[model samples]
Target: MGEKLLMKGNEVIAEAAIRAGCRHYFGYPITPQTELMHYMAKKMPKVGGVFLQAESEVSAINMVYGAASTGKRVLTSSSSPGISLKQEGISYASGAQLPAVIVNIMRGGPGLGGIQPSQSDYFQATKGGGHGDYHMIVLAPSSVQELYELTVDAFNLADKYRILTMILGDGILGQMMEVVNFRDEEKIETYDKSWAANGHKNEREHNTITSIHIDPAVLEQWNIGYQKKYQLITESEQRYELYNCDDAEIILVAYGSVARICKGAIKEAAAQGIKLGLIRPITLWPFPVKGIEKIIDIPKAFLTVEMSSGQMLEDVRLAVDGRKPVYFTGRMGGMIPTVKNIMDKVMEIKERHS
Candidate 1:
């Protein structure tokens, strides 16, 4: 057990990763997530770890790929534009079945849009950002505590699945200060490097790490095998938090910082005699689709709120499968919607239904 201490989400992420036994971090500084890089730079060396600020996001991600190939727990952090640059490397990591952690403190973007918070990358992340028939395990953190916990979980899940794992956050979640209990140093397990590409010594054969396959059938088989792993993860690793749904007539679907704001609105709506509940998705890729579907049969409409132009709403619609109406409320370009605004929307939905 550990005592809770106040810490910024970005700093907590870096600290937690180190405590979780990650020894190598390669990242290029980007806004909103810069605190994460600074924290790593100052602390990694003290713990006999490596922290390198690469030339660009491209270089940083490739550096991470190299470290991950050696079966070393490695990490990278960036905002939207920088993350876009790392997409190619992220795809390679997935295809090569290398376990690594990448944190995207999402910012408004189609291309270099803004430095503020946004959930526009939901599709990019959940659907495989780079070109390929591949998927990364995407974890969404809605609080500073979750940021700390998910960073540790991201590393563990990546290694367990032999794939890249991403902690999807936003500017507010990255910058906010909250109480978090840091895990003990001894509680973390050291990774086994039997599969890692640490130079082939005597009695060991050369281990090559790559995604390139010349044979079509062989590549197809590899893709099929990876999909099976994804299916297993989807079944066993879905994460979400449900709030006050026992007698609810309406449900709010949100994630990251947006989900936290939705929680307040949900509470207020309940006070006003509007039966509202919240479904906050913690793991975005292995999305809590099945869990959400189970609640859809209760005869309630869903409001998908986000910091983007309805990116997550599509997922909600898919999960609901048209059993009920799914509405969308969003604000783009870094605007944070107020609790009153969300409550007002909930009221509108309630009035319409009534």
Candidate 2:
């Protein structure tokens, strides 16, 4: 621990990326998450880093792809609609196997719906946001502190696997202020980027980086390699936090800030002699199936709470796989589900099961 500072989640993300050795940032302005770009603009030049405010989200992500190809740590961020625009470039990055960190501070959306917090992009982030048999490591941070910690982890994971990593947050976590402890002497890990297209001088062969494959057979092999990498990541990187799950009767499933709210619900339910537990998934893509598996025979049912219309409910259903009944309660278009809302659903499930 070096120093503690009171900062908003967006600012923490910007600072953490800097500390994690990121030197290139490319992004456009968008609501709720604009502060992250603003912070980068103010800090990057001072640290001898590159921060370019591109003309559009599409331009920014392509810039990121260019920077990443050079074996440099790079980052980009946007909200829902802006992230949508970057999907093509993200897909391109995935195809090329370039490493970069992308941040999505979610707001209500199907089409520029509103500038309020939302987890509606759960499916978009966890499932392939871009396209073509690919997945980015998706991390859902529940607080300003985690926004700092996970932003660093995002860059590390991206480099470690030579793939894209996504920090999936929402407007609340982006705007909310909290005290964050910065690591002064944390060792930033490095990887072999000999595969990067950063020029080999006259010593070795010049490295070439590209995502284009004209032949179907070559593309099929590329897809197979990507799936194998994804499987390895799935086996090694599933992360989650379980609260009071050992003796839980009704387990609550959630991620990001929604999971924070579920904790409150759990406490309230406990006071009323109801045993409620929560499973907070830190990595949305891997989905923490192992964590759920450990207590599969314990909990009678599951209640998945979200700020979207049951987007993550699909994953929970697959994880449970009919061994236990799963239920859902959510609010869309930026309405957050309150603790009372969660408890109400919990009580309803208890009644049905009883």
Candidate 3:
């Protein structure tokens, strides 16, 4: 425990990364996430950390790939379009098995969309934005407090699996302010980086880090090993929260800031005897299928809410596996789904089913 402080969401993520022993940051400025970079720029040098505002997102992600090769905790952040520019480097880092943290403060997008909040990048963050058959451990935070805590978790998970971890938040979460208790007294656990590219100093054989494998057999073998690692992560890392699901007729599936709105809708539905429950996914990559599996029989149907045109709906359907009907309601172009919208959709589903 430590003193609680009111902090902006983006700034707190930066501070939390610092507290978690992140010594390097490489990023380019972009809206809704520029404050995060600013905070890192201001505090990183003061704390003996390195912060570089790279020439571009592409350059920044490659720099992260380089720094992460040395086994130091490295981070980078960008909004939707900027993140798009970093895809190749992100793929490179994944190919090299580098442990790095990347944050996407999502904004409305399909190409230069508004700077307001949006979850349209759900597929990009969870389903491999970069080219390749790989996945990043994606953590979605619903509040400023969660923003602080999950940033630390992102770093730990990245190092634990030697894979990239993404803090997937929206513009609203990035700009909000709330009280957060910084875990200053908590000691961070360290992992062995025996595979790092740091010099051996003649005590051992020199280490090399590269993703290039020209031989098809070698690449196939490497991919097989990577798939095994991913399966392990998928089994161990599915995180979710169930609310009022013990006895409910409908289950609302959501993540990030949208989950907060779903909670409110649940309360209101309960008051009206509608019996709405919620499944809030904390880790979008693992998809929390187990959580859905546990309560699939309890709820008559599942309704997915998002800031995009049913991107997460596909995953929910696959998880439910036609055991129950799945429905979707979303608002795009910076429009947020309100409690009323959710309640209305619930009523429609109930009526049609009844």
Off by over 4 Å in 3: none
Count of clashing residue pairs in every prediction: 0, 0, 0
Flag clash pairs in model 2: none
lDDT of 3 by residue, 1-354 (tens): 687999899998999999889989999999989999999999999999999989999999999999999999999999999999999988888889999999999999899998999999999988898888888999999999999889998998999999999999999999999999876564676888999988898888889888889999999999998899999999999999999998889999999999999999998998898898899999999899999989999988899999999999999999999999999998998999999999989999999889
Predicted candidate 1 versus true structure: per-residue lDDT over 101-156, tens digit per residue: 99999999888898888888999899988988898989999889888888888888
lDDT of 2 by residue, 81-104 (tens): 999999999999999999999999
Cα-based lDDT at residue 72, candidate 3: 97
Q: Where in model 1 is the C-alpha error above 4 Å? A: 189-192
Q: Would you list the C-alpha lDDT of every candidate in the order shown?
A: 0.88, 0.93, 0.93
lDDT of 3 at 5: 98
Worst 10 residues of 1 by lDDT: 183-192
Which of 1 and 3 is ahead in lDDT? 3
- The stretch of ten residues in a row with the least summed lDDT in candidate 2 is 180-189
